[model samples]
Target: MIKACALLLLAFNCCAAEIEGLSAIGVGGIPMARQEAIQDALMQASLWNGAKVEASSSVENGRVSELQRVFPVQILDRYKLLREWREGSFYHVMIETDPKPDPVPAEKIAASAPAEVLATPVAAAAQGVLAKPVPVRECAQSDFAYRKKLLLAHFQLQNPADANDLSHFQDGLQQELSRMLSASDHYLPQRTVNEAAFNLQPGFYDPVLQPERVRELARRYGTQFVVGGVIRDIGAYGEQYGLAWGSDIRSGERKISASIPMLKLNGWMPAVAELGLKIKPSSRRFEADVYVFDGASGALLKQQRFADSATGDVIQGRDYIFGSRRFYETDFGKMVEQQLEQMVAGVDQALACQAFAARISRVDKDRIFIDAGSTARITKGDKLQLFRVSGSNQLVPAVNGDSSMSLGTPEALLSAVTITQVQPLFAIAILESGSIRPEVGDYVRFSMKESR
Candidate 1:
């Protein structure tokens, strides 16, 4: 049997072996049992693929000594733990291994090989069969490395109760949303806003005026997008247990008394008391209205209502307790995490597809300044294209013959400019080519492959 196994082992190399066996082991108490199980599974896979062990022996007089030698093969990089559990006293694990593809063999051309073998179709197919595979791009990591800056506002509470609790909850909601976006490879950390920049009265929050106000605020922050919204409702609500009784205290002997008469009789009395109470687990519900704004245009790009609920199951003694502190352990936290994930995903898709543009604030000699800054992911050494309005109807003689107006295509005015400095709200760049000079209000957009 050993010789047969050795023959099989010699048939395949360590790097190109496929796993085909089962392994089970008794696992004792360990802090890292799951990790240990994975390791054991890997070991079994290695041996099943094509690993071997050998022993050498030497004899002198009547004494003999033996030494063991083990030849180990490399294991698969990708594998799945199929199942893991404890049967009676031993923990058993099963694994499925994924092996790499076999190497292609070189084709040999004979002197009398048919001309059809060298035909385009046959030749191409043969070359493809032997060609190295093209590497697949990892979009998640690449998307993350793309630089984009954003700003998030503290979401307002709509119809909020005049209490401090609601305020804290609102703050937490905004923080969690921001945290989700920060975690992605999509956008950078939110830019901090200087509150004193926007001083306003009541109507500034009104629907008719909010967009313009938000636009102004975005300009000050120098960001591409501003996230703002109101939380509609967020709190833990109670669910009735529905006519159920739980024993608060078990029945036991409370008191006993005994008396003995001189003749022969004795009597004893006993008393007991038990208490019962009603209890129920409370459920938490979180609802919020989320919105995203294009900072440059002050236009509402996206609005969504995110909601989640969970059973507040943390128990304290005989009663169940529910609060924000304990919410993380409940299902509500998972729901919130998932919702935030979707929000970040949406932002990434929109930013990647949207057309981005910025306006020149001013120009000084060869240096130019634009109203977009680091908040919009403007990085130093980045290149941007320049364009100018041309052939507008305003150029027509207004007096008699032609008074109508028509917008014209933007003419290429200048070559790409290299960004030199980036501030919170704007960036400075120097033009590298083209005769047309940049002026205030000229439109600028990122050069291809420059912005994420």
Candidate 2:
């Protein structure tokens, strides 16, 4: 069997093309033959199912110009480039390999297999032999991991003052901060929550003393960062309400005075309130600004602010305060969760946008060529949009006999062409629309309407 296999391989090699300066296995180096094969393989990949290729050449510029003229036919794994060499007297070729396709998700394979096979450990153990183990390493403590202490100091208004109400409000704030931290993926360890302290002041606004208070707490708690803010009265108004005892009883009218308290706080409170208001039945208004600073230098790294309102009802014995004055339990808690989620989403979007920007690069074409073959990441049937970045005067041509005669202006549109082949740098697209034939050096962009 071995002798037969060897003989068959020998026969195959003998029949293979013997192009000069080309490698057959792609190991010796990329030559015309191997490059052609790689380009063909790229076209075969599902990424370019329907694509076309065009050809053109330039004389004045060097190899770089020719390369620019050549379009990317397919996307290969960056690691696939193995060898490169000169082809004939004028052409330089590069050979590459296809990237390994992503493995089937474990869930998919398990779902397809027999239930008994999936349930038993035998199959899993057998598969383990073929799979790579994830590496585990111990984590080291760093400056980024160091935890800081946060203190929120604010003044509470005592109109029919209740110490228990203030306590409940403080508890609500702490709970909200905890939820926000838990929801975030980047939260650091060693976060110490200091007990919220409320002071009695006559005025609606109290000086925000949390910064200094945080420093004091940090010394006592051995923490790195501090957070604080205040609560003040923004405005107040009166609402009229009617209470009826029975159908025969005339409704008794009464006016209730409502006061708006401004809670100027640091860190997560205001943010949670802002997000919570998006939910229905919340009416607690708050504005919070949070900042992270260096432990020693107090240099700020991250800062953000959020504002929102909460409204609903508060029960007072037999009577209920229903108009916009709600106790901080129900609405406040819900708001905190919503705010945390929004903050996390905002951070994720910003990071993703940055990453996306880094991956896309721009290239200009000097000549026109049909993108062809399976290796070029082109498909057998794909359409592309072509555009030219020419000046308005160049775009509009003068009448042949009358230079003064105005012709219609040119506009950008999608190419009416099917892709036949895809190459490394370029693709071959057949014109499907317009009477004018696209020439070399015409700028083209592609959109995948039917991606594989």
Candidate 3:
């Protein structure tokens, strides 16, 4: 059996042979074992039609060793997202691509989709294919070279539990989370974001205020996702095990136990007996809800609640900066650290499949420029796909509560280019294919599929 592979693992279990060519259908994305192994029969039939007829094979010891071809370019720049859907944890994206630039028809969208239309056919179709995808899917493995950009914004308190130390936790939240994701080596971290920059109050992402502001945040801060958090419960709550006998916890706490007088009369035996009458000790816990928003649209994408407990110094005050050495040394500090790990995982999972896109700042004859460079981990000779924004609009979920948002822009792939030169803030490239000349304000997207 022979398989056609892209630069990374684009094979997606799509194996091809001499007689059996690679199918236009690319089946990929593994969320769980049992369900992923069982591909949806309805989705399996999706196919791609391309203009290609090249397959080279090598045989070693009477066995086919390798099969190489360029049906789909080494970079997926030539591909187009055709369809996407999810069943349980399994999600699929069907795309059409070619060596030549192919244009998908523009779907008529106003400045924003009406909030009353839950799942507009146009919005449903544009889901991840055209708009920057949300609740993104991830590849099985991690990619180390490039780090996806993330902007950590404000976090709010659910209730004023007299935890004055947490009032300023927003700054600590930004600083610590920035440190956490940056340590993970999977995100380009920005932590100084505040409500002033986005022109909103705290928890704007909570109601999903002006969605266009996310695109502006992306443009100005160079981030793809905006994150916020809400502190729910961060106090001590008693545990009730009751020896697993289903005993009444309140009764246990109120049970009559031997006192010091009884201990003296019972010759020190009563004090020992009183220990069994005591209830379980209270444990300090930290509970918070993390909110993720698409930087392209202010739409809330994912909200995850995380809770963990520590044994000592779990509560913060006006003086404590979260994730500091003094704070981290305490039981509460460790619990917060653990929570940050999970938080980073959520952001990573949501963005792993979305392609990294950079805007074209200028386009000169035989020379094209993009706004990303070495800091983005892009190297020389890397190939990227060019696209022009046909137009854009705003999109909101239906009044009935559809959970999707759209940037409402249709794009046309222009050409593939190899990075010719690099700088700290920008990169230069020359077109390798296609006839549509690129202009300023166009976009170049990295073709590698694995953003983990």
Candidate 4:
């Protein structure tokens, strides 16, 4: 797994001040909501100021132990808190920042404004998850023993010229993504059958994953995140005559690029385009959108498009079955594989800081059953923090505005649980601290990453 450094790279900044309005939950036991809102805004400001996220852990068996982040003092100093207000249980802050936006690699932060991301004390984000999470994690723990889950729902086609030839993309991409992620150390993937996977859709045109759709997916699949994609085009590149390949081959694969937008996270203002890959004249082109939805909130964490073109062996008709040896032998297969690699890399970065979560299936006496077990890599004797949310655990819009979103459910901590028995689909646990009753829909989460 790649350690994704979520550095906010600034572009050609004319030393212009930017306005960022961010929010967080102040309700319940969230500690400092006002500060969190301010910090959140600063994070964005730093991103635009070429800030990189990093982590340092000194706590071990012997020495005075702790996990911490060292922020870029200069970036923090540049942001001025314009104003702050509260609505219902949410705390909102509007900050004005001066940024010179540039996308610098995580390794290159030192030459510029060097600020490391400060991890919290309780390991609330995830165990040793150094990357900034793409989703909100108020009830998170840093536990390495468990890996976050991904459910590949469905891959769609955008009116293909050779629909049958590109048929493999509909489900093949899902299977292939599942295979790649399953082999990864950071994430576990839930395989989908056609009957269960076909119906799920992220959205069309500008996509927005609905909350209810996410809940249903979580209920049926028991996954932490749901991922889907739309194959926008796999055809010819406009009217330019191919330099080499047959007209039929060019017609099969779709057209894309020249001005392709990259990742477009919905909540944030302007869409982020890391690279605008261009397609060559008269070449077989492939382009698609990949989406990652949080099971907890159904919020679209990642929406990225990858475009690549090849001049040869782009399969026409159903010349070869997808993923078959013959298909892989073609240049088009290699192109698709390259995009899949990018897609998986994106998924890793999106989910890296997310905590491992399992739904409480049943509560009998002092024993608790969770939907994830050995199949999801559960081990006996593991301890997890338990919590009960006021409502369904999802991030929803705050009462008054859309500028900020809050975890709809104000989670109240319950007693910790010790895993005593493990199965493939379920695990049995008992309260480690108190003797109180928990509910079926409550959650059990690892606070930090732990050694396997």
lDDT by residue for model 3 (1-452), tens: 54332221112223321111122221212222112222221112212212112333565567876544333212222333444555565444544332333222223221122222213344445432333323312232234446667778666656546244443565776788888888887777786545522332455534444556666666677676777777777766564333322233331133434445655578746445444343443467778887777665556677788987776344454455666777777676778788888888887766666667777888888899987888888878777777776533424445655433453346666666778999977899888753558887788776453221
Mind sharing the TM-score for model 3? 0.55
lDDT of 2 by residue, 158-190 (tens): 332322223344434444454454344323213
RMSD of each: 25.8, 25.6, 17.5, 19.7
- Candidate 4 TM-score versus the reference: 0.59
In the range 194-308, model 1's lDDT, one tens digit per residue, is 3311223444442222554555666666556777655555555564343322243211102222333432332232221222233443565666656666655455666677777
* TM-score of every prediction relative to native: 0.45, 0.28, 0.55, 0.59
Highest TM-score: give the candidate number. 4
**Ranking of all predicted structures according to lDDT, beginning with the best and ending with the worst:** 4, 3, 1, 2
Candidate 2: TM-score? 0.28
Which tens-of-lDDT digit does each residue in 91-169 have in candidate 4?
Answer: 7777775333344443344333322332332332323344343332211222235666678876766655535565475
Report, for every candidate in turn, its global Cα lDDT versus the true structure. Answer: 0.50, 0.33, 0.55, 0.61
Model 4's C-alpha root-mean-square deviation from the true structure amounts to 19.7
Q: Between candidates 1 and 4, which one is better according to TM-score?
A: 4
Candidate 3 residue spans exceeding 4 A from truth: 1-145, 160-162, 166-168, 196-206, 236-282, 317-319, 394-408, 433-435, 449-452
Residue 177 error, candidate 3, Å: 0.9
Comparing 2 and 3 by TM-score, which wins?
3
**Once model 3 is optimally superposed onto the true structure by TM-score, how far is the C-alpha of residue 285 displaced, in angstroms?**
3.2
